[model samples]
Target: MLDSGLKTQLKAYLDMLTQPITLVASLDDSEKSQELRSMLADIAELSDKVSFDDAGSDARTPSFDIVRNGTDVRVTFAGIPGGHEFNSLVLALLQVGGHPSKTAQDVIAQIQDLDGEFLFETYFSLSCQNCPDVVQALNLMSVINPRIKHVAIDGAVFPQEVEARQVMAVPTVFLNGQPFAQGRMSLEQILAMVDTNASARAAEKLKDKAAFDVLVVGGGPAGAAASVYAARKGINTGVVAERFGGQVLDTMAIENFISVPYTEGPKLAAALEQHAKEYDVDIINVQKAEKLIPATTPGGLIEVQLASGASLKAKTVILSTGARWRSMNVPGETEYRNKGVAYCPHCDGPLFKGKRVAVIGGGNSGVEAAIDLAGLVAHVTLIEFDNKLRADAVLQAKLRSMPNVTILTSALTTEVHGDGSKVNGLSYKDRTTDQIHRLELEGIFVQIGLVPNTEWLKDTIALSPRGEIEVNARGETSVPGVFAAGDATTVPYKQIVIAMGEGAKAALSAFDYLIRQVPVDATAAA
Candidate 1:
């Protein structure tokens, strides 16, 4: 018999488990039966806005509908919305209810009087936890106002939608029937798009024209490098970034970059931007490139359109958009990020010197990070879902030899334990033994993998099945005069040096394409 308070809490938790609970299906039949009844009763007490009538046998297939005021906001709670995903869902529900936060409300108030409707559809994969945050922000907008309709489609479940949308990655947001933003976006950023589009529509009423020579789409290391290189070559280059520095800005430090022993990511990014400015590159910070179209001219020019309704014409286009880190969709993860939770060991490892930490993932990156951190941190606990580490035997032997490193095979992070401000430990389940254990740690590093920033280019360029843009050895894409470099391209290793080298290669290729235009006699004379 369970204590009354424990039973009530369990019932509340079960009620929230809309789907057939496969997550704990391993429990004895009698216990499962009792819990199901308790959960159902709890569900009956909640408002009519939520229902679990069609919950499938699989825990991942929990179907539920949200009815607000008189409007139905259909939603399916599949899997556990833990870690970054939890924050994402909350924001999504708020959006569905039209309850915008003060910040969002102010932004909304600025554009609510507009006459046109803007619809945003976002597709996301569960593996990429960052997607949920962006989706939730968009959902909040939808709830506060009817003019903005927001729909979030889980890529794994909606195969047709994924294929139709050409969603190559998670958190791809489409605005006004066209793919608008990719990856995670802030509330202010999305609102700015609405403001920009509205203003653009009004500008169209007045009629205007804008143009440039070269337009760099991203502002990370690659994009900044491309802009600087293009400007140095005397091309009228313009760069538009959702936020300057792209994903690298989130990273704390970068030690792999050549020539520099070690430098913080934000500082490096700032220097790069300054260098590009010195070369006369026009940079528009906080602006997003919504779409790219071929130029009307025959000189291999391209037209870049911004979310703000402004457009620029360029003789060439270079996509240096980098990749984003993959996240664990477990509970309590996002709440602790950067506060004892981190993604880059090389960047944040030193910060945890002499402190206990956990590294999640079975792949080479995970093993490598654990091995490296063991040398710095007091102890390292490596957790992998698979039975074995996927690292090279040599590295595995080295890691195993480290007395301070503990390996937990077939373990999955179920929840991150923290003190609201920082991570204190983690709870995980052993797949083979069905045992749950919580281990204390001062920091957690997630090295699962990376997702390229290439979804928006699905219809615009050729991409590898892995979603990375396919590029030739020269960094040229299938589209002539259009090139991609860095993690966004099909590069084997994602390092700052590699991205920078690729950016230089792409710039030279673009230059070659331009120099060919010189007259035959003039070229011979030079």
Candidate 2:
């Protein structure tokens, strides 16, 4: 039974906690359960203040909510908040309490004094095990400035929400309702995006416009190479991409990419972007092309429209949009992507060095990736829906000789199992025996195949039955002024070197078309 006086004091304390007051509580074995209940009651009381009627059964446990008082702040918690998160919670309370350390205090002072509100959401997979660092960092920021609020979501636990955001990797952070960063980012990088958002908002008020020439749609090796070459040729080249690195950014290491004996995908992509920018290539990050239409004049010009309603006109266009990896579309697959679920072994295999991994597919790509991963990872389990591997005989023989590779033919991956962030294991049904068994592994790589990003070009240009762009020997597409290269085109092989060579060929072809339109004297000099 509780006394009226104690209940009143508890309610007051809850109000204070909700408003920038900090409370730290520790418990011993005998009082642990009771202490937890008391703390939960306090949180529940605060929930009532914020109009959370369904504060639910676990009021003491960490949850999510949006509080708006002229300004809106989204608050969320990851994990139980009883261990490392407890201290983090305390700091968060202190910061939100309106008192913070010198560095945080300064930033908060600036933010709170601002007129508009900033909303942020961070997504993480529980299996990442490294995502807690990001949560703690954000908690510290929240303590310094209440204006900067965050929502932390478990990628695996929330399928619908994760899908809506199109979260392909863990530690993905969004600011002002837009994707700001992905993977593990430092505190400075996170803050920088916040600053950028603030500046962009301010610029929007000013209403300014910018233009460019030769806008490349993708930022893969092919696009990066094209941007570098085009910018050097003095064309106002600009590369707009949803991500800076394209598909190769997720790769682990490249032993086969010429000139670079060994390199990670992020490192390689960074270098490519840097080199292109040095030549004055305007690289626009986090932008997607909504449509590509022919120019009204019909002089081989293209009008590229962005999802943001911004448009650019280019005398010539290069289509180097690469392919996306095929997924299994199984229940747990989405939740575990990049956690225990992967699409490219060459991109993530080194991270699982000496650990067990599963390769799903039996085609050439699957066999090749499995063979490559076997050299680094401790064990490789190859699961194929078909009864046999479709790889070349020599490659199959090599895979067979490798002691770490195990082939499971006529099998299907039914479900992926993990806590939430990473894959701990998976279950598969053997077609031969009609028995399902779970295999323990640290990762699962999906190497089914690649699908071209040419779906949008079906009506705009000619496409092969496989959805790849139809290009001539000189890399000219069926359209007069448009050129296609890389994996998106009808290239026999999909290799980085091959893509680079094709991009160069396409650029030369575009230059030839340009020369034909100019006067003979000017054309001869060019």
Candidate 1 segments whose C-alpha is farther than 4 A from its true place:
1-211, 253-267, 290-298, 305-312, 518-526
Clashes per model (N, Cα, C within 3 A): 9, 11
lDDT of each residue in 61-170, candidate 1, tens digit only: 32223335345343333333334454555444343434435553536665455456877877665545456657766666665566766656565555666677776555
Local distance difference test, candidate 1? 0.69
lDDT by residue for model 2 (107-212), tens:
5554555444655677765445335557656755554456666766665445677788887666778878888776655343455455646435433422343444
> Which residue pairs of candidate 1 clash?
82-330, 82-331, 83-330, 83-331, 95-139, 95-140, 95-143, 98-143, 98-144
Worst 10 residues of 1 by lDDT: 19-28
lDDT of 2: 0.68
Judge candidate 2 at residue 331 and give its lDDT: 73
